[model samples]
Target: MSRKHQWRGMMGDVAEKCGTTVAIALMEKLGGAHFVVPKTYTNRGPMAKLGRELAEPFIAEYAGQVVDIPSKLATKRPPPESRFQEVEALIDKNYTAAQVAAELGISQAYVFKIRKAAGAPKISSKVDKRQKSLFD
Candidate 1:
């Protein structure tokens, strides 16, 4: 199904379970708005539950009135000053880049970006030496 139809169906389900007002509010608020769902929703069970409860009521009241979902409300968090430090710490603790990415709910590429930004030595690979290898 199309995303719009899917959204409508989900909203219908929410309304059926929660109430029409709550569902309508949620649909209107989320419709055409770009936001990320935070890892806290996955990490802290109680906070996530509470967040869901808090979301419905406000969603109902604000709905189409809101233009942009604020960072405080949405999952798009502020940039961390210690992102590099966090990555370094994980590496020092013998965590693989993939492990760090899973832990941080980010991608391996993002971990590499953080590693590069920290001025760490690049990981040399056969790909890097390919032309030289071919000539030799």
Candidate 2:
């Protein structure tokens, strides 16, 4: 059988024994690694990283077995243009460049670039000398 078939079979077994949620968590966490499920769940074991609740079912079914999880589970990124549009929309809503960058997981510089490209006014950080302080 092909490696893909083997991977599917292993994942199916995990899903059947541990439920789909555990199977997916295993795939996401242990993908591309030959991970051995311990016979007994331990806080110090490799499965400990998954936390007890998520690790127990997998250990019950796959104890002492080395699972070869595929590496194709990486999340796909949205297109660059779509991301740019998202930045643009956030800027239009008057979100600060830092806020836009944090919300979109992009750099502040990239947010500034998008703001400039959209012809949005730059947000100033300097305090006005003549402005009265709220605490005064």
Candidate 3:
């Protein structure tokens, strides 16, 4: 499929999963000031082609009224308190942050935050001054 077609298909899937109103809200959120069409579509004009097709449903629903979708609307709740201990245990078991985050339905950045807050040791490979240098 063409890239444009793939994008439209993905958007359709999003619409199907979240309902038209939510899909439109999500589109507007991603579109910013342009709103109806996303930047990628506008940048090259392919998205602009489907502008009317996409907008009709949303326009009819809103009756030309302007509305805002709250930025703070939470899609999913924060990982449970026990998740912190789980994160620590997983780290002890050598689980990567990405793995922990995936299992916990949270972001990898959040996993790092939990680790930092828990005083976990940094997992880095810094060359120690006492170690013999390859150049030496």
Candidate topping lDDT: 2
Q: Give stretches of model 2 more than 4 Å off.
A: 1-7, 72-136
Q: Clash pairs of candidate 2?
A: none
Best by TM-score: 2
Clash tally for model 1: 0
Minimum summed lDDT over a 10-residue window in model 2 is located at 71-80
For TM-score, candidate 2 versus 3, the one ahead is 2
Compute each candidate's TM-score over C-alphas.
0.33, 0.46, 0.34
Report the poorest 10 consecutive residues by lDDT, candidate 3.
Answer: 1-10
The C-alpha stretches of model 3 lying farther than 4 A from their native spots are 1-82, 125-136
Candidate 1: residue pairs that collide: none
> Which residue pairs in candidate 3 have backbone atoms (N, alpha carbon, C) closer than 3 angstroms, thus clashing?
none
lDDT tens readout by residue for model 2, 1-136 = 1123233446766767677777677767776678777899888856876789999988888888877765444223232344667876765676777898899887797667655665655657434445699998
Model 1 earns a TM-score of 0.33
